[model samples]
Target: LEPLAEAGVDAVVLGCTHYPLLRPVIETVGARMFPSGLTLADGAEATAAELATLLTERELRGAGPGGLEMLVTDLPDRFAEVASRFLGEDVEGLAVKQVDL
Candidate 1:
């Protein structure tokens, strides 16, 4: 936060899927750290919108059930717990696997 403020950053983008969860904390810190007005962009929302547009343009929208597969480099249980928060549902029975790079 300090470095970004020092660098005169005007905006911060939440690029990762989990990053939106930290938006409030990040905004609070930015408010304290940044002298000028800072704009926070939600990349998750932008990505979702773009994906929907692309699907519609490509005529690839699906009408069937959707499946999600998660792969983690480490800590599958912790990832599942955190992912459940983002997904707004329990991921207990979801297929999550830990893989080596």
Candidate 2:
């Protein structure tokens, strides 16, 4: 953070997908928000458009989303109950691993 201030990057992008969830804290620390405000499939479309331009410039474009593979690192006790509501399907017959951490 200090280096960015010294080096003068006027705008910073928190590129992590989940960083948007910390918008409140980021603002409290004096950062700006420029959100596309789209999720999931919509996010994929926006991503594709933005990436297509860059890939065309450098010719690095290739197909994406070979398939979906979800692996969660810490399955909370209530994960089953809450996941179905968010994922829109019952998460039965799926095994979640437990770790001490």
- Worst lDDT run of 10 residues, candidate 1, spans 13-22
Q: Model-by-model lDDT, in order? A: 0.88, 0.54
Clashing residue pairs in candidate 1 (N, C-alpha, C atoms within 3 angstroms) = none
Query: TM-score of predicted model 2?
Result: 0.33
- Candidate 1 — which residues are off by over 4 angstroms? 85-88
Q: Candidate 2: give the clashing pairs.
A: none
lDDT of 2 at 23: 46
lDDT for model 2 comes to 0.54
Candidate 2 lDDT over residue span 1-101, tens digit each:
44655555445565655455554565555443223221222354478799889988998866666543335555644655566665678764466545563
Candidate 1 residue-wise lDDT, 26-94, digit = tens: 989888898677899997898899999999999999989989889998799999888888779999689
RMSD of 2: 9.2
